[model samples]
Structure formats: structure tokens, C-alpha cells
Target: MTEVPLIAPLWTVQDVSEYLRVPVQTLYSWRSSGTGPPARRVGKYLRYRPDDVLRWLESLDDGAA
Candidate 1:
């Protein structure tokens, strides 16, 4: 049997903010400073990939500390 991989869905700024529990303004600030997960502008809206966001969150985890 072969395993199937799930595809990550793209999220909006508002969605990402809510999921990350951060203010929308903070996400904008991070985007300006290039410190946030990768995002791309689709038309006039900003979109983020779930995979990238999860990876970024994982990077912030501090299990060793």
C-alpha cells in the first residue's frame, strides 16, 4: 500500500493571524521586516501556505530549553 501526502492549503492574512493568535498588525509588521512565514500576494490579497506556517512555528518550538 502506498501512503498519500496531504496538500497544504493557502490561508489569508486574517486566517493566519487567527490561527497563530497574533494581531493582524503584527503579521503586517513581520512581513515588512521579512521575519514571518513566506507569503505571496494573490491579486490584492496576501496568502500564506500552511506548510510554511507550520514549519515556521516548529522552528520556534523550544523543547530543549
Candidate 2:
């Protein structure tokens, strides 16, 4: 039998803010400025992939060094 891996749920703006320890407004500002983790527009809401968020954080670390 083959095993399947579980998938993570898409994150909301509030979820990303809490995870990154930033204000929700900051995320909105970053989004507008095109300097934050990538997000998708789903209907009237923005959704983020957890993997993309982690990659963005890692990129920051890479740039800092």
C-alpha cells in the first residue's frame, strides 16, 4: 500500500501575522508594496501558502548574512 502525506491549510492574513509576530496591517502594507510572502486572491480573500512563508523568512536570513 502507498501512503499519502497530509497537506497544510492555506493561511489567512491574521494567521500569518500571528506566526510572524507582526500586525495584520503590516502584512497588508507589505502586500501592497510587493515585499512580502506571496499570496493568492481567492474570491474576496487573500490566502498564503505556508511553504512560501517559510521560504520568505529563509530568504531574509540569507540576505542578512
- Reference-based TM-score, model 2: 0.84
* Candidate 2: pairs in clash: none
Candidate-wise lDDT, in order: 0.91, 0.95
Displacement of the residue 34 alpha carbon in candidate 2, Å: 0.4
lDDT of 2 by residue, 5-59 (tens): 9999999999999999999999999999999999999999999999999999888
Model 2: residues with Cα > 4 Å off, grouped in runs? 1-5, 62-65
CA error at residue 15 for candidate 1, angstroms? 0.6
